[model samples]
Target chain A: MAELVKVVVDAMGGDLAPVEPVKAAVEAVKERKDILVILTGQEEVIHSELKKYQDYPTDRIQVVNATEVIETAEPPVFAIRKKKDSSIVVGLKMVKEQKADAFVSSGSTGAVLVGGQVLVGRSKGVERPPLAPLIPTAKGVSLLIDCGANVDARPSHLVQFAKMGSIYMEHVVGIKNPRVAIVNNGAEEEKGNALVKETFPLLKEAEGINFIGSIEARDIPAGYADVIVCEAFVGNVILKLYEGVSSELIHKIKDGMMSTLKSKIGALLVKPALKQTLKSFDATEYGGAPLLGLKGLVVKTHGSAKAIEIKHAIFQCVQFKQQRINEKIAEKIQPAQFPAPDKE
Target chain B: MAELVKVVVDAMGGDLAPVEPVKAAVEAVKERKDILVILTGQEEVIHSELKKYQDYPTDRIQVVNATEVIETAEPPVFAIRKKKDSSIVVGLKMVKEQKADAFVSSGSTGAVLVGGQVLVGRSKGVERPPLAPLIPTAKGVSLLIDCGANVDARPSHLVQFAKMGSIYMEHVVGIKNPRVAIVNNGAEEEKGNALVKETFPLLKEAEGINFIGSIEARDIPAGYADVIVCEAFVGNVILKLYEGVSSELIHKIKDGMMSTLKSKIGALLVKPALKQTLKSFDATEYGGAPLLGLKGLVVKTHGSAKAIEIKHAIFQCVQFKQQRINEKIAEKIQPAQFPAPDKE
Candidate 1:
């Protein structure tokens, strides 16, 4: 029999957690019998939430018993240190001990980042574990690395991000030879600050990846590049703005359709088709961002996430585990991909 | 006699420059007699482009004769240093010497930031001169500060930004007690990175401005905040993404409308209304991003700008000059606005 892909989840993490998480966990286990979920939270609170799902396999949905929750207000380092029994820390410990294949959290992002580092550990030869987020685009989804991991990063780090992110997209997400581009003020090679200027040539010279010169902010939604690499500061801003504007646009479109009587009538006539088309704009479909380049996987879902978001996050882990994304990165970095220096 | 509001135009700057700049200068002079536009560029090129505008005031549109043009490829610091007679440099000099009230360019943005610093200088007590770009929102417009001025900035700089941007929005854009917020990953003050955490208290303690706490990106288009404060790198990204996604959505909507005969008929029925609404989404209406907190006014228009964009930029300067935004900013920074030691 194939080994079960046990995933540890911080059930007490998010705003609507325990409830949404329990629903998602039950659904995930129902869909995939080969999967097992270890929900970590206050035993009483989690049990009460999980009681709604009577059909969930008791053995498959075991509780690790985390007593405390990390408040979003606490300093990340302080929270990670003090809240040892917090869901995030406990779930990470499960991954650390190989009790689970991955750890999923819809919790305080700061704690997740800290817990991932302290418990799961960074991958071999990895300078930083970037938060590689899969952003939905017109063409498909592009993996945006360093979305909010390391704020102050170097050029060499960005090069590593490009390579590692390319590995994730190519193997796990199933994109081949992911086109990587450095985010810049302009599309021109010399159009950004010192970091972008330095990273440009390095990314251009990188092998086993399709290095596109540069991409301006406007090209992102159109899916101009498959792997958009940038420092955490830039990546964080882009990801947030991307989420903001897309949501705003959808909200406006909906509002516009509902404002007038005639428009409302028109909206009703086109409701089904419009909803289907606009559903493509939903960022939740892409799942949570992965804290990539870690020994054990950690996925950080949105704090305001619902049951659907949790379900998608679980699905993402399955794909991530099946693809052997890390091993692929090691293989890509082999001396074979790099040419011998003329053998003179 | 009223003193002429002299405007300096970098005629050799922008993609459609010479032609667009000359036409915009002519149109502006016609609109306001107290305005004098000094067209700086290669004399021959200026004359050739100027010939297209037959009704342009030949005497008012004086060609300042710049010998060289700063290519976008050149490093900002090096280009500003070496190209003494470049259009960007000449334009800056015109404003610095009080020959013009404002300097407008659709040229290299980095060069503009460099030239504004090297030429126009900074306002007294101003530690940083933030680039405040006016972005169109559903509720009129918003001022996004530090878009590309200082890449790595401090929490104190953001506090200054909130004051300056609020002043501009109130005095120039005619919004009172303009809601100012620090852009962050989450709406809660406790969320976001170190910079955001540091800035949150300062913003709250800041007086003379309506300091709304952290605002997520998705809230921007629905017009959540009047002034959005962030470091240049983050601000630049948000601005660019807003531009990009809006363009993408417009294209997608247009394409979708043309996909079927029924949809095309639907589009035709709503063509006038849709055109009116979409026109408001045009980037040109807001004109250029002003390098605020400078001793003299400096504006950076889009590089790919045309005559209409130039015309709008010139009008934006008119409002900036007339509104006396700097005086308001100085008032906003009074001792009373700073938090008392006890509060800290």
Candidate 2:
């Protein structure tokens, strides 16, 4: 019917590996006729996994032989350089060479980040590609940019993050004129470290985006802003601690519910509604973190991602391609559009 | 009775100023005959609030007049210097003059931090004083040091923090040979930004502490380490985000439990057991954050603290005095005991 969006899936990556990846590719193809998936990994392993699925369009899915796999423990840059035939590297190269419209991986986060940059490369005028993930918040969800990509980012880098994040939230996440805010210890503009202080005024003066002021971490889960901007170090801490605190509390509540016979019966009554509410907050349901500003779309899902998450990540790439997020990012981050802040 | 540990309560501080602080002081003196409290604020306000409570030991609680009040919005350094007659300044000055063994406040965090360092002063060889708060964890509580003070910290400063945090945790929290870990994005030694990278090696080689390498933010809530060390910016994010995520999830759970009639009945049944279980994670139940390395103890309660939390903070000072936490810190952080790392 329409032009197919070709997405390369890393079959040998993540904890579940070929099983989950292959299953997800099949599920994706079954649901959507306007996409094709190229599963990259060891030929035999992928073929055997594919055999378990029947009655799928044989022509839509293809297997590309990749002899090696990049272990999570290996150094990312070295792994990307050495493992040319690995699924992560091969899939990224396919995107680089324009063979695929996008690439999806649940591999070593470090490797995916590096390969996404070194292979697919940054778009012209994009200073650095950032890994922007959609974290669930009380209102809905907000895009947290630069979560693990550039730990030591400069003021200009943060400025670009705000711009790119706004574009992403507006287009893919479909939030209109997404409010962008820089992460700070306090709500005041004068309350951040050197980078945030420098970037605050620039964000206020930046063009073509809805720039809100500084947001404290306490207001983050309340969803005060649609896009949360910070250096990778701060973003990583926020992301991980968000997961850590929520899971711990959930565990404690469950334990409390089962401590007594009355509460145990109560737990059964509230279980379905509670599960439905929490499901809205699940990160995996939102798919992968996209390494934005890349020449081609590249998404990195969790290393522990299951088949459902992989399927969502694949579907996510379709929207990214359809919405032309990269072109919008390129236009917004153009050097001519963003002037450097005056030196103090 | 043992020698009285005189504590100055800032009756002009916090959201519930003279009311809560005065009540807490009266409560503290009634609970412990070995402790005395000095309420510093407007004399009339302090006296009137105290008059509401009859039959409390009159001699144990005294009101010292402070004419000025420091608002939370005022710049910390300027307010501490100009507002000499403010309750915060007067109380800290009393501790400096040895008229009080400890100073407790539910006032502005910034003014308290600045006043603690400037008025109460640092101990010998203490490069910087850090704000260390005990955060609730899955197992129990862990001390998160430098949560708001020393935002732009150096490697040597963090090393001192680790040492100071270890001393406080082992002595005050009663955790013997407490495990100390620096916050990092990853678990590996080579996996941090400039600050964390430089501090990691120094922490490893430092003596008089049990060093447990790098800990990611995800492991923090699981009580992976007894003393969690980080510069203020990262630590602040972790602390605030920990609170943010937990409160939001708890709110969501309550809403979910009341969404339907069946669930509403179930919520009532689970209410008591859940409340008890969640109380263990309430931070105010533990007490205030102590500004370590000071000549006299200074504890900062939350700005929103009620009478109960203020009482707990006062009781916490009694333990600090009894355990000789300052003396232990003075011994542990001596420059001779902590050799500087070799310059790269």
Candidate 3:
């Protein structure tokens, strides 16, 4: 039998706290035979929540006491440094120490990013680790690299993002030779700001990845590219705007449907199909964003993530470890600057 | 009677070209007696299209001969420099020469921006001219400044954008002391890229405009601020993403609503209310982006603009001229630097 993949989850993080994390871990272990979960949080709180899950597999789940919790509002670097025993820090360290195959957190984004870098460390030859998330498009999903990690990114950084994103999409998301395009104002290479304009040619010449030319933001929803490369500022704006617009539109539609009796009947009839279609666009269905290029896997989900999203995020690590993605990433990223000393 | 507010229409621009431009001019002239439109294009083609409109106000609309047309694919600077007799260039020159109060084009955005700066010239003391467009929000419309004009914008340029956006909103849109906010990835002042971080404090301290600190992209549609300021790159992304996401959502909703017989009935029943609600968010209702801080107004509508949009854009010039927005912009922007050389 294959060895079990041990995953460390920050049970104290997120809005729902120990309840959702403990509940999700219980559900995950029951559903999968080759997975184990280590819940890092205050022992008493975790145990109390675990008791709520009856007929659970106690053997697959363990508890590690973390004395502190990192609040969302606190500064990330300082908090990571100061709160060494916090759930986030503890969970990340377990992955680094090889006690866990991966670390998952739905906590303060800054702290997760800081912890992922400082504690988990970067893979060999990784210049700047980027946060790549799968955003739902009309066709399916496209990976948005450097969504909020490297904001003031240079041209070189963007090229690396495209490379890493291509690796993720090809291996993990399972798209072959994914079409990669730089996000720009116009489709032409001459268009875009200094960063995009400079990065366009480098991406065009980069090895391995299928480099499509520039893509306008308006074409993003059409799923024109499998891998969308952009600096964090642009990526963040696109991601946030996508979320904002979808919710506002749904709100407006619901309001419109409820305004009249005839429409109300129509709403009831359409709710199931509309809900199903919207579910396809829901960010949670795709799981969390992996802080790619880390020495150990670190995934960050939304702060308000529920059991389903958390469950998907944890299972995501199983595939990540099975594929040995970090080794592949190190190989793809830097061929000469730094070679993996351990590899033959 | 008051002197006519002469407007220049680029009849050879946009996808519909002379047909839509001629039709729109006829409608504008019929709607408002105080406005006159100078249709600049191949005089024969425009006249032929004009003949389709029976009993049109011949006295209020006139045609001016412009021999060339600027294609959208042409490089903006090269096109502007070479296509001297193009409709865009001819219309802009009319505004510069004071033969027209404002210039309206649905042609290439690049050409319009280039000609607006070179031909119309910048208002004295204005560091850079920004293309400010009114985007539909849930509450109403908010002005997005520097949408595509100044890509690599400096902090000083953003301050001027905020000032100009404030002036346009208050004078034209009639929102007093309109709350102005800089678009950032996060709401925290320290949380943006280098450009936004540098621009924040300056906007906070800048006088005249109501600076409301940083606004996240997600909160934009909530109508949190009347003036949304950013460098052209970020602003353009926000605007395009807004367009992309809205259309995608509408498309998905329609598809979902038609997938089943029950939902189709619901779709038909809810069509009226939904259409009415969505019309409030339609961008064309707000007219074109006015390249703010120009000596004379230059409004750029979408290339796919129809007759109604063109008519609205032309009438928009009337209000801008009536309010003397340019003189006001100069007074507000450069009170300390130039002191308005010819001020009363």
Candidate with maximal lDDT: 2
Per-residue lDDT for B21 in model 2? 91
Per TM-score, what order, best first? 2, 3, 1
Report DockQ per prediction, comma-separated.
Answer: 0.33, 0.81, 0.74
Model 1 residue A21 CA deviation in Å: 3.1
What is chain B's TM-score across the candidates, in the order shown? Answer: 0.93, 0.96, 0.96
| Candidate 1 ranges beyond 4 A from true positions | A10-19, A40-90, A124-127, A154-159, A188-213, A258-271, A326-344, B1-3, B30-34, B41-90, B119-128, B154-163, B185-218, B259-261, B324-344
Pairs that collide, model 2: none
Separate clash counts for every candidate: 2, 0, 0
Task: Put down candidate 3 lDDT per residue, B1-344, tens digits, no spaces.
Answer: 56799999999889988788888999999988989999999999998998888876799999999999999999899999999999999999988988888999999999999999999998888889999889988889999998865589998899999999998999889998999999888887778888888988888877788999988888888889999998998888888888998898899888988988888877888888888888888898888899988889999998988889889888889888898898888877864464335424
TM-score of chain B as predicted in candidate 3: 0.96
The TM-score, computed over Cα atoms with residue i paired to residue i, of candidate 1 is 0.83
| Candidate 1: residue B209 lDDT (0-100) | 79
lDDT tens per residue, model 3, A63-86: 999999999999999999999999
* Ten-residue region with minimum lDDT total, candidate 1 chain A: A334-343
Write the residue-wise lDDT of candidate 2 on A320-340 in tens digits: 888888888887886746565
Candidate 1 structure quality by residue, lDDT tens digits, B201-276: 9889877779979887778777899998988877878888998887777666666656566565555554555555
